[model samples]
Target chain A: MSFRLALQESPGNPWFSWRYVQDNSDTILAALREHAILTAEAMLIATAVAVPLAVVAYWYRPLTGPILALSGVLYTIPSLALLAFVAPYVGTTNPGSVLIALVLYALLLIVRNSLAGLNQVPPEARDAAQGMGYGRWGRLFRIDLPLALPGIVTGLRLATVSTVALVTVGALIGHGGLGDLILTGFRNNFYKAEILTGAVLCVVLALVLDLLLAMAGRLLTPWSRRAVR
Target chain B: MRSENPIQQALTWLNDPLNWTNPGGILDRLGEHLWISAAAVALGCVVAWPIGMWLGHAGRGGSLVVLISNLTLAIPTIALLTILPLTFLGFGKPPVVVALAVFAVPPLLANAYTGVRSIDPEARDAARGMGLSGWQVLGRVELPLAVPYLAAGFRTASVQVVATAALASFVNGGGLGQIISAGFGLGISVGGGQILAGGFLVALLAMLVEAVLAVVERVVTPKPLRKARGRAARRAAVATGSA
Candidate 1:
């Protein structure tokens, strides 16, 4: 039985002719893996920068207003346009360029949340901590952070979901993800089933990723339960 | 065409009367774009409300529903548009509508669920104590309270769906997206202008919808909260004077 026949015969079968589609599947999956890694990388970098900057912003509110406003403006740039603008700078199709764009996008969400979460740690709480003789760092970690955990996690979850969706667009520049399958299926007008498969897989992946993140939120932020309740 | 430089030629091409008509031409297309987005949002609400209500009433696994909604938002609109026509065929409004609905649902669902869940326990208990049946309590007590939150969700979903549907033009689904995508293909100042015009129109429409929804939300919000905020302001002023 030929690979084509197998795909045709079992159009709905995710595993149909797995070996023949191995290269293509790998390309798609590898793109997805790279997307995950890129988001994780961007999150780490952005969080590291955003957390300290948030503290600075909190301490010197007037000075950080311009920066925050700039980030808000940057957030309005259509995602694809930003990617296209960066294409020339980094040369098109480079994963690094995509990651750079993702990092900028993530920064807006991360920074906003970091600031909001910090602000949410009531002024009185900070005053109380100070009066308790805890140093700023100690107070930040012990009291403020725990209180702000739910908001911070909410921001992270939002950023991660948006990143997952945007990374699929990276497929347009030859970075293959499940989106590559969908795009290729459309471009060639071949194998409608393949397109369906890709779309379904993309939806499934999103749902699973969301569930995992929600679980993580539940676990990491003990305070989230209180918020939910 | 041959004598002119690329920029000049592109500008000349764009200045063609057929393409560059007056206010009427632009307004007609703009109207069509607005209609499509508005219709899609309405359709999404119609579709989302039942599901949102069901999830909210069930009350168990409310967080899970919100999580799913967040993920639904994560499914990039372009990817969904690109994929929709493959299996569905017939490349026009239906696919665009479906895609927009998909984009719209998450916010709607999340808002509905949140609104329902956020109701004050005493209010819910009071309704129950009054011998209101479960359905009656939900319809009367819960939904009224949830209106502002749901409206907030609707406002978010409306803007999101409108912007996303504009991208449907990439699939030949004809909305503002066609103008922008063609502009991109033109790849010059002319293309840039067209894209800008199309994008600006869409953004304007989104802003208008947001403002309209803001008004609607204010109208729909419960009176108690408004009163509470008023009281808080007065108290704060009193405290400031004392200090």
Candidate 2:
């Protein structure tokens, strides 16, 4: 029983029932926008760095082992530990901290898939392209790339889902979006509908994102459609 | 119990069961976390197993499903945990469980699906030729064959759930996370030690599960693979001797 609630719900009640939900909707919405943008930016950054590295690593198998091993070690580190480790360089409250972690997590997937996809290309196909007087770049684009598209797309799809989910961790830093609502519910002492609402929305976001990625994978790999039949 | 002894004082405070009282106390909280994780993983396996089986039979869809599941692997549980309380309105095990299930689903589904899809075409065709119905064939042939893969999936999901369940503390759902979080309170050594212990305990529980499953996997591996493995070992020994 607080003052705010007594004024609104029951005059005798003293509880100040602040409508956190009402007050925070706009903030959450704004955070979602930032989250989406952050995810996209991180993916772009990670791809730009990882894909070329993967290609070069593919050409030299020795580098692939070390890069992959590094990614595996990165994977073992808990997300919070990684964030706290890097908090000094980039303020934790900012979107950049979470975004950077997301990119790091994604690098392994992108690099592994890229290298695997490239290696999966039939050697004869590349030979044929080379025989056609295609240089290294031409062979890569014309012959090797199309074959590897499926794996690359697979990696990107993985990276996207991961980034979207990870962006919520940024909420601890006072970044908005659903995480803000959930964290508030937590700090406010107990379960209220507001917290559950945010969580459900996040799960829905994940499920919807998963389906969209699946559709995208299908579209990207037309060959798969035939292979299924 | 009040003493000038620093080490004894810390030990008594830590060992005191009375410290963990209240509604969301330490011991009760750890129990809640395990319960939630166990429930969610059990439920996830039920859903994932069938989907995995169906996907395995459906060829072409294998990579696509794998791709989708892999993507889900990317979404951090912490983010999901954070968003859950807000969207679901007041955090509890339900949202946490859902988040965990999403995390656990990919490995189970992917492994189960791959197991079925990767079954020898000859074996499937032979089963079909014997007039065995699709369901029967799947039950008798496909499933037993896929056990090793399913076990692998289960192993991955189990460890994942245990580790991620720590996030449940963020939303006040209580678990080992509360102990860990409480350790962050004051005296860094006191708090940090608790957190370390809780993390170690969770890791140990997860490893125990993995080891038990590894035994099951070893048992499930076909006799031929075991025989071949022995032969390979013998050949290696002989080659080394000759060299």
Candidate 3:
């Protein structure tokens, strides 16, 4: 309550003016929190759906084309257009509209990467698993998924980063993460502090999340680095 | 009796001839969207392609590519555009162009680097053995070999940019997003039509880019390499099927 956005927007102030931090600390933090939460939620949901769809597509080869094609076409739709297109159907106020679009954007990356990761498991590895009496589901989870971890993580990283960026576009639909601050500033005669703060927070958030994901990828697949050494 | 569906209402409005002929009509919006996307892609190539080729040729700075790519992903372009006006860059097309250009770079860089790196070592050696300079080797051998990847990269970058260029409207850069944004203000029944028209154009732009690039990819891939690559792919498909 005390930390509402700063009242005085210094448009003439330098972009990096210290005044932004002094004035709009609360708004910046709130936007950051919202952005992070939405992005994370979207990625998690995308992964949940995409990974399984990819698995099914891999299992049934004929499905791959249709499955990937759907996402590919969806990917071409502009973020703004998609938001507006859905706004009528879902009600403009529904955050689900934005979340749904973000999820769609993430799907192609997630599915394609998951498939690539699964494909990366050498045939011999699969043979070894089968020979070792691993059942189908057991082998998929234990052998295939672990081996594909690096690839899947790569997809997740890509999707997460893009989602983080696109989530800002959601501001147009009333659910824009840090995008709201930027839009707020833009609408209110270019409130420089809000715009600058929003932009900086988004970049910082993307970098931090990207790094964290990379580290997580490394941790998940420790042996990936070993082959080089 | 006609349905008062918002989408239908919008379509009816879209049918008006005024939209097609006016100064701020659909055709103008289409032109703006195309120019913005094209400019972004062209500038992106100028900046990113050479860096990628250099990294690929050197076979170094792998981590540098990763960091740059991450930075590209992390920067929220729409937000960045809003901030740019306050900086020395000032407002309008410059900021929009810069943001879109930055967004377009990563794919080009990554693909160019990878395309070169994926060249056959034996082929590279033969080029060198034939008295080719490093640049000659790159131009004569690696460039042709990398055609498919380059096309693929361009296709991806262009498609994404075209879609993203819709955001230029937010900054008054003027593109198909104007229709969508305008539609939002016009309300559900009437505005929905404008939004649909804009989205349709943007999506069409992406699909067109993809289709053209796919054709170029097929045509420019060195014939022998394409045949060999095709065979290898078929073999892999067979193997996957059997497995």
| Candidate number achieving the greatest DockQ relative to the actual structure | 3
Off by over 4 Å in 3: A1-12, A218-229, B1-3, B227-243
Q: Which docking class does model 3 fall in?
A: acceptable
Instruction: Name the top lDDT candidate.
Output: 3
Each candidate: RMSD: 7.8, 9.5, 5.9
Provide chain B's TM-score, model 1: 0.79
Error of 2 at B14 (Å): 13
User: What TM-scores do the predictions have?
Assistant: 0.72, 0.66, 0.88
Per-model DockQ against the true two-chain complex: 0.21, 0.10, 0.39
RMSD value for candidate 3:
5.9
Best by TM-score: 3
Give native contacts recovered, as a fraction, per prediction. 0.18, 0.16, 0.59
Residues A19-91, candidate 1, lDDT per residue (tens digit)?
4356576765765677667667767776777667767777788957876766654454545545544543464
Q: Over the stretch B1-243, how does candidate 2's per-residue lDDT look in tens digits? A: 223333343345557677566566556765786798898789889989998898787665666665556556544566566555444233456777887887788777777776787678999999999999989888988998777667667766776676667667666566666654454443333443454444444545555665676577668767665554333322221111100
Q: Candidate 1: DockQ?
A: 0.21
lDDT of each: 0.63, 0.64, 0.77
